[model samples]
Target: MDNGRAAMNLAVLLALIVSLLFAQQPKQVVVTGAVPDAAGGSLTITGENFGFVPFVTLNLVPLTIDAVGGNRIVAVAPIKSMPAGTYVLTVSYGPSPQETGSFQLVLGDANDSRSQSSSDVPAPSISGASTDAAARVADRVITVADVDREWQRRDPAGYLGLIRQLYDNRRRIVDVMVADELLAREAASRGLTTEALLKEEIPKRTITMPESAVVSLYQSLGDLTRGATLEQMKPALRAWLERISEPEVAKMNYVEELMKVSARAEVFLAPPRVQVDRTPQDATLGSDSAPVVLVAFGDLVSASYARFAQAFSKLTETFDGRVRLVFKNLPLVGPGSIAAAEAAQCANARGRFWQYHNAVVLPPGAVDAVRLKQAAADAGLDRAAFDACVERRQYQSVIKDAIDEAARYGIKSVPSFLVNGRLAPDPPPFLPPFDFLKRVVEEELSRQTRKP
Candidate 1:
């Protein structure tokens, strides 16, 4: 009887080992490439292991697949599913349930505003002038493509801002270009050339710079005069001061003017927004230039987050890409909570924070050491390193600092938030959390719009 029992136990153990081995076999799937287009356009996804069917999402928003092939997916992303910004595009196939990666969608020429030049720029009226005069004076619609072409024709420095992300150089350049175009269109509408209108308007607004200030600026620049008379530097100094003071010109309502005139002109407009922290250490999603930022403080084990995880996502979607979110850790529960926080940070280090967050933290389930490891695996984290990170408590101080910061703010709740540095007030109990958050966001947006 003892021998029979031993054999049965050995057989059971062998079966378990085989099952584990089969489960560990890698999923045969790979997203080889993507032919991305404008935000609302179709994105062709080329990949393997899609099987006969697949599912897709852009930041958890379901996508409508127009056509599906063995290794291709032609899908129509919703109208605003991806505004001009970045997103995590996820695809699910038989071998891979939810394979995810990042992709940036930029608005294309279909939204081009470029059409015609100002008719007031010495153009011939239909009532008079020769054929050559009529052709020379014709309206010129400006496409962003045309703007780009003109940019290329102009100095490389003027165009560098468009392609380069180094500085907000693009904003500076685009502002000038858009304003110039808008001004031209406005001038034409008033039956005057842009140059003529600017000549009249600028002189009235130009400030008289103090002589002492101009001299100081010249000396600070190590005398670009290069042994030329101080008189020579005076003009340059005055010019510099004048240009700096012209920000008022750039701040005009160019977009409104363009819309009023129905002129085709593409301009990169800046969002009116504020931010307290712009660090990647605090998890951030969406464009850096987004107008509103929602900062939240919570422990990974907070049950409160579970109630509003979907709500938070909905709030983000409802706002389009205008609002960016930042998540900071504040461990308040226990050792399990602390460990989970550290594990989350580790996953964040591996760029899997969102996945781990959904699977482990916000999911409606109790967490333990075993559960934490399983969550890490489900989040597609590197298990051995994740285990090491959790054991070592690598992000312990990070979580502690965040918790201390939350305390300083007089926040004792697990799901506290600071919307653009203003503590979110207790929202009305009648509305859902998502609606409350949306109201908070809309209020902030309205406030920004009201600002000069």
Candidate 2:
């Protein structure tokens, strides 16, 4: 009987201990409220059974506790220092812990909440509510045709914009249609084809772009090129910089040398005073105080642009601080080419336009969205930001206006130059392309000096 009584007492004591332990166990914490999408704001948390001093963690990093007493605790979110993304917000109570739920740590200023902007409007055309459900049942693999079809079906405006190249070729034909019989006859008399002369003379007059020079130019461009190297981009770099140092190294205007003996080819044409100097916020190179300014309207993807850019690079070096060149977007090739122009503008936003200038050849087959992002990655740009900007088409109107203005100027070709308000004719026997440009700038300088 005594042994039975002892067993009962022991059982009762065990039950009491289990009850005490159960009473001490902490309650599940619920994150009831968090304010402001990103960091740097008060986060309100509540859990009735929490210990006097509970701990809080954000994105696995322990945050400084402000106060933790009662059923509710307030903790300050990390000071917007954490990168922008969705992070798990965990609140722990007492010793026994359980974690759940997340808060999206947004990017950008919290105070500048932009609900009133025009972008706030509902565009159900892109809402794609159907895609949310369709994605699961849709083909796991997407194809070119699928993307194209979906793109056209989803964004009809985008489809129309892509089809409409702002620059029309017929306008250029009319501008150049004045018939250069005199220039043609002069060329024939000299037994020179402007094309053939350049083909032969470019080699004789142009210096090879050295590996060091190429590397120097590439490195000097800074973050725009990112981690690109001379060897990897050698062919493209060589092509762009090939003639940059030629005029300096050769120390002779091969065009002037030829022009001295031949009758001057005078095609009296003036570029319409269309606005080329857009703003200081453009991609530019050379001295702001220079006497001559070159407004270059060139296509990034054009083979002709590569040549023109090289020639212009030479002028910048040869002109003795008397010239400034501004690059205005004239994307005439197509949407892909226009997209490439937009990519350059995106880089410009980051002060990496020169690097992007050199890496104009880095994009994939064409400057599509995927290719532009890849190129941005290759260029070491903030791909997320760049991709977002491209999607927004922030610079579309700016580019379109430049194209429209080019059409107004009757610019139909890839690389058209305006030197101090004169439409620079394509190379004739007397003036090679670069030399003609140099001559125009010098004449402008002379005129500027003579102004009384």
Maximum-lDDT candidate: 1
Each candidate: RMSD = 27.7, 29.5
lDDT of 2 by residue, 43-77 (tens): 66665544565555554344556777676667776
lDDT of every predicted structure (CA atoms): 0.63, 0.59
Quote the lDDT for 441 in model 2.
81
lDDT of 2 at 12: 100
Residue-level lDDT of model 1, residues 1-452, one tens digit each, is 99999999999999999999998664555566667655657778787765455556543344678888887888786544444544445465422222322233344444444545666678664233222222222485444455455656664433443333322455667767777778777788889998787666666655555665555454434323345344533433444444443324323533445545647655434332223444455876565677888887777776655555557667777777889878888778888788888888899999998888878756556777777788888998888988888788888888787676665444567677777766665553223457667888886787676533
How good is model 1 by TM-score?
0.39
